[model samples]
Target chain A: MENNLCIAGFGGQGVMTFGKLLATAVCDNTDYNVTFFPSYGAEQRGGTANCYLIISDREIGTPMSDILDDLVVLNQPSYDKFVSKLKMGGRLFVNSSIVKPTSDRSDIQIISVPATDIVVGMGNIKVLNIFMLGVYIGYTEIVPSESIWKSIMEKMAGKPSLVELNKNAFEQGIELGRSQK
Target chain B: MAKVLMKGCEAIAEAAVRAGCRFFAGYPITPQNEIPEYFSKRMPEVGGAFVQGESEVASVNMVYGAAAGGTRAMTSSSSPGISLKSEGISYAAAARIPMVYVNVCRGGPGVGVIQPAQTDYLQATKASGNGGFRMRVFAPATVQEAVNMTYKAFDYADMDRNPVLILSDGVVGTMMEPVELPPMKSDDEIERIKESKKKISCIGHPLGERVWIKPGVWDTIMWENINKDAEKLYESWADQAEWESFMTDDAEVIVTGYGIAGRIARSAVEIARGQGLKVGLIRPKTVYPFPYKAYEMIDYSKVKAILDVEMSIPALFLEDVKAAVKERCPISTYLRSGGNLVSREEMVSRIKKLASR
Candidate 1:
């Protein structure tokens, strides 16, 4: 099976980091092939930032795709720009605190999580992306949740406080995601 | 060592370091900035020298000096930046300096865009500089292949005592994938490599036995001889021509490309195969040698049409493909230029149309 995912948001929203974390986790833990490609250049300076992540059982082809099996949008502009690229029956994960889908698309599934508000409530906004990652994993179960936690630990290895905060945020996201399921 | 996930540009830098590259001087350019950025951090760890040259020309010339002093040196830049470095490249080629460089190409005739494009095909294979000198150009489709080619590029340059090119583009440079890196050359090995070239390098020797190395030869006969030797060296690279043929045994349509375009075409071939279309792919791993034999070996009896896929407007790589095919079958082209990428769905549709015809 192959899944093409695009994560998009404002430049400082950690869109690329989210994709990288997932891609790295899958690559380091499983035999699945993965590729992470970012939208770069002038557009990345205070503008919209996005990245593509492809995870496949077979060798991946192009890292960029016109159509996506899944799209994660953290802001309204990202949702407005990329929502059309999602295929019918594809999954759309959105940050409910910032993005409100104006279109009533019946063919796709929209999973809205109040990620920004939830992270703010947790007293640290930096873990917002990691929390969304947890939500994605909890819903899809594409890989084990422990794999993601292990990846988070590895990425946040140097800072003990940040690790604890991110772990708490991720667990909260997983609980919310499981409830949605 | 186990595999690790790395961006293409970073992987290329690490591969160069592992290959005993001790000196790197390059200017930063978008889509390939990571290469220089990587070297800035990595070179120090390897006990090597890294310089952020004031300009691309200076960077390339710095590499020329380093390589002339018997060090494994390299430089990288995007398309327009590479144009500025052409003079230095020509000098290195003329003086027979064994050095390696990379063109992480962006769209351009002149600063076109920062997105990936295969528009530099002609510039790389036909005319990298004014001297009309040729270099072994490796076009890798995947990060793994990029790492492998970069690891071997130093060896190729040293073997021929000439410059080498890794012709990559923005797509390949920015993408990240898992790759098994080559083993690092030990300090002793690096020292031995430098010692091997001591006699020919610019190291000081007795005045009576001094060796002069200059790109220019005032005598016409001497320049002609240098050109003749370069031609012979290029000719000897026939055995190094490499290409990948996928399911072409019974294919009625053959698709061909190099670099990332070639990679996307391979995927199209697989998708078309699932649809029961007899489509195959010929992906050239080395663009300079052109892999003419791979085209020559195509069974004319089975193949009806050849589809040349590339990301260049007028198709710069088409000339090489045409020369190799020798007009055996009708050649069609599917092109996307100026930072636009060729998609698998489009290629698959094109192959189906050719197959139906």
Candidate 2:
């Protein structure tokens, strides 16, 4: 009984990597089967880096999610383009620091958080991916926060020191999530 | 379950899918592009793998790689793109890994026109690659036969442990007709090969040290030396190629062609028969076999000529037909190329003219 998530942002916003990390985390750690598809290269450059994820108890053949339960937009263009595509009652989380004038929908729960500002204060601007990943977990526990940390370690399986910095960034993201709500 | 309207190229792809070919790798090449496009989305829906490769070389190599991993993998291409894959095709033959390659032939000798031509007949039967190995070559005259025979290509490839080519022309590939696809291989036949990767070629020893080796130089040499009996390799592909014969029991003139040319030749023979000409078609479903026995069994007393028609420039199959029926009858060529298909009326007129001369 997992959910479908769409994470979108500008070219270098780490949206594709974040989606892949979540997919790998779910597939490797959780019981929920997962599928992930990313837009890359020619068709994707300068437009938006979007990824569709399908997480369910059964086999998810098509990775593309026609219906989205959670949508996270990291830029104004991404927010403007994908806001109306979310399923009814779905949660919409906006990085208000970069994404301005977010959509106003009465039936959907909207979180306006300065995700990048929190990561910038943590002294590592690269931790923005983790900060948004934390918001994703807070809205819907599709994958455990612990698995995301494991995923960071797994991703840097060949690197040692980077793992330490990512673990710290992950903790800082959790702290930001706690202080915001 | 019954006849379905499908393009000839699409029928070939559908048959390969029904044959339990779970993996397909190919790039877009006209005259044969539909083969991959038809199966790209369809194969994945049924838990199969489909990859649109960067190029024909990469595509065939992907097939070779996946097939060596114990999955039934296939690829399709036309003349120009197929030329790039000859290296891999030879490698597949040398490895005897059983891969299906479909060549929807276009007019060739260069970047030939994207029109139906049996120009690759020599390239297919004889080694276009740098080797002495032969691939099992098939030529289906009709769309329905193309669908039925495509699965046979996979089976023969696997059973003989050799590469098999379904050589069709542009007309054969692009033409649409009613094709009733048979369940190529039983579900169990392929199910047996599902876990085949686990033992069929995987290395042995402690789990940690056992590297995932495919059908490579080590295994091929090891098996070759293990079963050094030449008869084993000979027996492997003895029954691989075959064909079809109609009214050749007592007739003299044998009209030889394959794919679209063969289809046109069939109607030509019928029209010639209506004019009291004793002409009959020798359509080869598997051109590699050449039906030498059928030609040898021809009643030479009544038969005076063998008219060989093809889309290539007197380039292929004509010589093979000559050798098969050298002492039996005189063989002549009615060849055409560069994007033109032989019509039925023209074939009949040619047969009639040849008979009179």
- Predicted model with the maximum lDDT: 1
For the second chain of model 1, what is the TM-score against the true structure's chain B? Answer: 0.99
Task: Tell me the tens digit of each residue's lDDT in model 1 across A116-172.
Answer: 999999998878888898888888888788988888889888887787788898898
Docking model 2 quality class = incorrect
Residue-level lDDT for B250 in candidate 2? 56
Residue range B208-228, candidate 1, lDDT tens digits: 887677899899999999899
Give the docking tier of candidate 1. medium
Q: What is the TM-score of chain A in candidate 1?
A: 0.96
Clash pairs for candidate 1: none
**DockQ winner:** 1
Against the hidden true structure, what lDDT does model 1 obtain? 0.92
Clashing pairs in 2: B116-B170, B252-B303
